[model samples]
Target: MAETPIFPAIGAPAPDFDMPASKGRQVSLAAMRGKPFILYFYPKASTPGCTTEACDFQEALGALGSTGLPVIGVSRDSMKAIDTFATRQNLDFPLASDATGAVTEAYGVWVEKTLYGRKYMGIERATFLIDADGRVAQVWRNVKVPGHVAEVMRAASAL
Candidate 1:
């Protein structure tokens, strides 16, 4: 049996990351230093759930940005796929490609999952809200799409 992954606790420093993102740019923890941000992990690009989540974030971007909390989506998909998805969704926020799974694992979103009695390893739908000091302020795991962005926005607004 695989050991359960441990997530970074609230108030802990967020794991660092540097990944290729849409619009031919790099999204990294270093670049977001001294700034609050949202890092959301999704299972795949262009999938139903992921699409809804991405689109919701896009729609809420202006409000979230107003709170000084930029959002970044991460997935194990390749850059090509991420770029295509971002373009299709008309997303202005960065959707980063973690082709190597390093960032996902570091953040503890990579885990064992079972569907219809079939077990597999996959990225869990999770989100982390990191404060300006680089500490984790909030976390959501096994996230349900409906009303999720609004919940995140509320937490960010409080920060």
Candidate 2:
């Protein structure tokens, strides 16, 4: 019964958000100004596909970080869940908890999904590449986990 949110368009300012992140910190799009960053949304923390995507991003952290870009994973999971997932997966980047689903809604990743013929509302796997000035430079919707990080790296490196 949830209304789908309109996704931000490329070259437009990304939705600003400040959420509780793992490691006892807060991350905000505003704070990451003057540098490009990646904001990826996942359905949940510690799930199979989400885990693979997070780990892949973690593994590519060195290459991605070399571009002076920070990568953040967002989900509707609680801080405790995010913290535990990060610790268990050895994730070196930020994993933000969007418990209220507001951030996910704003990003337009909070969507309707169906599996096995049952429809439900959930966060869609999506990623936004925001440029240094806060504009969204790229977007990937319904993301497939494999080789995703590498693709993002290629686009980011070109930025």
Candidate 3:
């Protein structure tokens, strides 16, 4: 298991990362520093909740982008999985595969979870909002997909 940081504290610098993107490009958090960013970490690519979240963001792409806040989805799945998920769903934003769990750990979302009373390690679905000055604007951990992007937007709009 990777070493995950404690839950990212709001008002701090968001932990930095550079992971493999679905488009074969490795994106660094630094590259997105000048604009608000939505960095969401999910369990895996193409899974039910993950897909719903991705699609929700996809459907809200225009609205979100119009606000100048880009969304980036992260997961432990491979780039192939991300590619298939994006093509199949026609997702407009980038999806990064955190196959090594480095980014997950950095954000503290790779955690122990319980399902049917069986505890195991998995991602705790979460989202981070980084503001233009590279500060951690907000952190949403243990998130549910429904209405998440809207919540992020609501928060970002106030930033």
Candidate 4:
């Protein structure tokens, strides 16, 4: 029900958004300036694919974390869901809830998805690599689950 992000080019400005984070704090994209950031949009917290993505990031935290970048996960789930997901998976990164789907819209991850020939609105698993200057450096849309963190880590290290 929202517009997809126009998806700024590799060197274009990363869209700025503020949403409720897993820690109950407001996270604004601008506040992340001066450091590379991983903005991954998922459909819901605790789902199979979503959980895999979060855990992969968690498992690779040593490499990605060493880069001094923030790995932020966004979803349309609520704080309750995010809390449980983080606790259950022992995820180390912050999980933000975009209940209204605004942030997902800004990032262009909210779109129609197909499952068993049924089409409905959902969050596409996607990741955005925002550089230190708040520009989009790389983007992985409609992401597959396996080895995603390795790919993202490789991209982050190159930045």
Candidate 5:
């Protein structure tokens, strides 16, 4: 049996990441310091659940931004795929490509999953709220789409 992955605990330093993102950009933990931000991991881009989540975030972008928090979505998809998804979804926030899986693994979002009796390795639907000091403020694992963005928004505003 595979060992369960351990995630970064609240108040622990968030794992550093530098990834290629949509709109021809690079988003790094170093650059995100001094401000709280949302880093969410999804299994794939443009899928049903992922789309719902992304669109929800997009709709809440204004409120989130008002709190001085930026939202970043991460997936193991290629840059081309992520870029296309972002464009199609009209997402203003960055959709980062973690093709190498390093960032996902580091965040403990990469895990073994079973679907229809088939087992595979995939990225878990997870979110991390990192504070200005780079410490993890909150974490949501195996996230469900409904009302999730609002929940995150509330937490971010409280930060």
Candidate 6:
């Protein structure tokens, strides 16, 4: 049996992590203190759903940033793959690589998934809204791509 990872709850400090991201830099929750940010976990890069979600976020970047929130996408893909995805999608936000899955585990987005009777461990689409104090303000699990970015933008705007 797999132990269930403990996800951070609302009003609790978010689990901190540092991972390699595109543009040849490391992104960390610690560095984002004093600013609200969005941390969204997706299963893979360049896939249809993921692409749509990413592009939606990209399109709303201006609006989302108007609330002074930075957005980040997390995946277990390699840094090279993340770079390509960012470039191909013209993504302006950082997409961090969690090849070791540690960050995903900490965020509690990594879990066992069954698709067509085949079971595997992978990222479950989830999003976390962290407040300027570094505490989680909101969370969405098993996210659907459509209208999701707009919803997040609304939530971030209210923060």
* Window of ten residues with lowest summed lDDT in model 5: 1-10
Clashes of each: 0, 0, 0, 1, 0, 0
lDDT of 3: 0.86
Tell how far residue 26 is off in model 2, in angstroms. Answer: 0.4
**lDDT of candidate 1 over 1-159, digit per residue (tens):** 568998999999999999999999899999999999999999999999999999999999899978888999999998999999999999999999999999999999999999999999999999999999888999999999999999999899999
List model 5 lDDT by residue over 1-159, tens digit each.
556988999999999999999999999999999999999999899899999999999999999989999999999999999999999999999999998889999999999999999998999999999999999999999999999999999899899
Supply candidate 2's per-residue lDDT for 102: 83
Per-residue accuracy of model 4 over 23-100 as CA lDDT, tens digit each: 666788888989999989888887798888899898888877789878999989989999889999988788988888
Worst 10 residues of 6 by lDDT: 1-10
* C-alpha positional error of residue 133 in candidate 6 after TM-score superposition, expressed in Å: 0.7
- lDDT of residue 42 for candidate 1: 97
Which is better, 2 or 4, measured by lDDT?
2
Whole-model lDDT per candidate? 0.95, 0.92, 0.86, 0.86, 0.95, 0.93
Q: Is candidate 2 or candidate 3 better by TM-score?
A: 2
lDDT of 2 by residue, 45-74 (tens): 988999999999988889887899899999
- Candidate 6 regions with alpha-carbon error over 4 angstroms: none
List candidate 2 segments past 4 Å from native: 1-4
**Which candidate model has the greater lDDT, 1 or 4?**
1
Query: Where's the lowest-lDDT run of ten residues in candidate 3?
Result: 1-10
